[model samples]
Target: MRLSTVILPVRRWSEGGRDQWLRAESLGFHTAYTYDHLSWRSFREKTWFGAVPTLTAAAAVTSRLRLGTLVTSPNFRHPVTLAKELITLDDVSGGRVTLGIGAGGNGFDATTLGQEPWTPRERADHFGEFVPLLDRLLSEDSVSYDGTHYSAVEARNIPGCVQRPRLPFAVAATGPRGLKLAARHGQAWVTTGDPKLFEAGTPEQSLEAIAGQIGKLGAACEEIGRDVEELDKILLTGFTPDRGRPLESLDAFVDFAGRHFVLGITEIVVHAPIADSDFAADEKVFEQIATEGLAQLAG
Candidate 1:
């Protein structure tokens, strides 16, 4: 299974963020990501940088590792504007960029934009329009369209993406509508499973919950007449804090990876041990994962 890590942009941009990404690449990570959020959870008061620029910088320095946002939502970004940025990032990364997108959540990103809270149905409808418009913008030139939530007026993508047609999209989903959207449009489907099940549960319990979620995704693919095997399933490890002990050691990570593999996850992205702003501590964890965890996998 391919391995990745989500480096949260909760810290200051100047504080070794670039160095940490560089270290991750040198240490054999397949891809590295930063969270796409304006302000996240309890870290709202903290310094947070934009995911696009952070990932762009990561792509500039790393040649081997693929770069992406953990997930970008349409809450605060226009699809047309984002498409232009993503294609440029794909070019700069030499086709090593993936767009991890979602229907957005009721978080600080939503309310802070001075937008009203949308109902679940409204969010799904918005996502339906958002993903397709982005697909057209990157794949076709001089696209003009109008939709309920977004519109593009004769938008010309003079030079298209390096990845051809468009860069890869890793779509995050859990609900039926979201799952179907992922099945229809995503190169990869990403999930963190049910939050309630993970809260105060063991690793084994979390695995079971994730398995159910994966099954739902498979069902969604079948309903849409899509081959489930053709889409990559990405499991987000340690996504919920209350999911018992975090996989901090190589053995822990290997065990987690093995379980996910058995559950049909082709890729797993682990969160680094929260080192706050300490890049050295973060680098140590990444180095060990490369040397020990990946070595264990290889062996």
Candidate 2:
């Protein structure tokens, strides 16, 4: 399995942030992703920068490592504007950009833009409209659309993306509607196990829950006559009950990854060590995992 890291946008680009991206590339990480948010859960009061700008800067500095948002959502983003930014980012990164997108949750991002939180059904509906329009905006030269949640009139992305039709999309979903969207539009599928199991469930239960979710995703793909194996299965670590266990050591991560690999996971994304945070871990160990963990799993 390919190993990646999520570098939270909490540090300023001048101070220690740029170093992290460089280090990730040097360590041979497949991709270095960041949280796309106005403000994330606990990092709300921290120095959270914008995801696009941070990624743009990262693209400038890194040559080999792919850059992406762990998940961008329709929360405070319009498809027209986001497509423009992503097209530019793809150009800047030399076609080394993947978009991890999802139906956003009822977090601080939900109400941050002077709007009420959307219900689950509303979020799903908005996502259905958002992903297709965004896909069109990136692929076609011009787009015009009217829909329940979003409308774009003669929106134009002239030069378009560097990545042929568009950049790859890693759709984050666990629910039926969301999984169907992923199956339809995604180059990859992402999950963080099951949220219900994050706080109280055992590791075994979390594994079972993810297996069930994968089964649903397969069914969703089958409904559309798409082969599920055509999409890469990605597990964004740290949300399952196993939490930091995988990052505890190189051996731990290999074991953790092996378990998921059996479940058809192709990519494993771990957080870049953030001292004293929910994502805190040993930096050396994380680097070891980046460099050697996947090889160990193969062996």
Candidate 3:
């Protein structure tokens, strides 16, 4: 039931965005994550910083607010490189780093730049293979792997990560395979949306869908002989509405978040105002919304 904040796909990073997260730490946020997609949300533009480095910047200034990828693509980088990146960030964050890995979104952002296209099944298989390597690299001095799309030498990760065996790993999943993968391997399961109201659809339908997803995750854990209770479920939602939107007044964003977020796990992560709404105009607006939004969610 812990609350985490996230940066979404259709969002951009501004100086104001950086400040927004800084304020998040003092606001009592447990985790702060960002996307690592190459494709932009609206257009086909690329975001700055591949992913790990941007979090590096987030960790540099904040003493609290755990840093991680909202969901780093399994295909975008190799396991060795990913392990290295997670280790480095863990070092910088004093072991307060989590790694949110996933198959990534399928859009111009992921498949553009002449990258390969993977069937959903392929990505799930790849993720299943990728996760175990993370543990192997972190736990052992040397390792070997021979999988469908991966091959690693008996290479030593050298000194390992700051979090000892490895850092926590989370996943963003909404499909059968993704759900099972998230349940079997991920320390946590995160989804993107607004918890207060169905930012995407009717609230009742969304609630039903969310409850179904959680049930599937629990079933997946059962299939694998793992206890679903051992894992945490987190929803990444922009619960606080714009100042005067229809749901804005009724938003009681905090209470709404509590309602939807508690559907299964009894807790959820609430995202706030976006970073790209009005870059130039909302500089102060970002500060104001983030400050108040933090209090609303935390309180």
Best-performing candidate as measured by lDDT: 2
Candidate 3: what lDDT?
0.66
**Residues 1-299, candidate 3, lDDT per residue (tens digit)?**
46566654342446465676677787666777776776555534533445777788778888878887777777567887777777778888888888877776566554676677777787788877787777687767788888787778886777777776678778777777877877766788876533444444565665666787788888989998999878777765542232223124323545555566567554344444554542123334433444454456556
Q: Would you give me the overall lDDT of model 2?
A: 0.94
Q: What is the lDDT of residue 226 in candidate 2?
A: 99
Tens-digit lDDT track of model 2 for 147-196: 99899999989899999889999999998889999999999999999999
Write down the lDDT of every candidate, Cα atoms only.
Answer: 0.80, 0.94, 0.66
Per-residue CA lDDT of candidate 1, range 1-299, in tens?
88888888765647777777887787787888888999888667877889998888888888999999879988888888988899889998999998999988899888887889788788888888999899899998779998878889999886989998789899998888888888888999998866776556566677788788788889998997888898899876655533323255566667767777888988878765565532223545556876578568657
Query: What CA RMSD would candidate 3 show?
Result: 4.4
> How would you order the candidates by TM-score, starting with the best?
2, 1, 3
- What's the TM-score of each model vs. the native? 0.92, 0.99, 0.81
Candidate 2 Cα errors over 4 Å, as ranges: none
Residue 262 lDDT in model 1? 88
Worst 10 residues of 1 by lDDT: 239-248
Best of the two (1, 2) by lDDT: 2
- C-alpha lDDT of residue 239 in model 3: 28
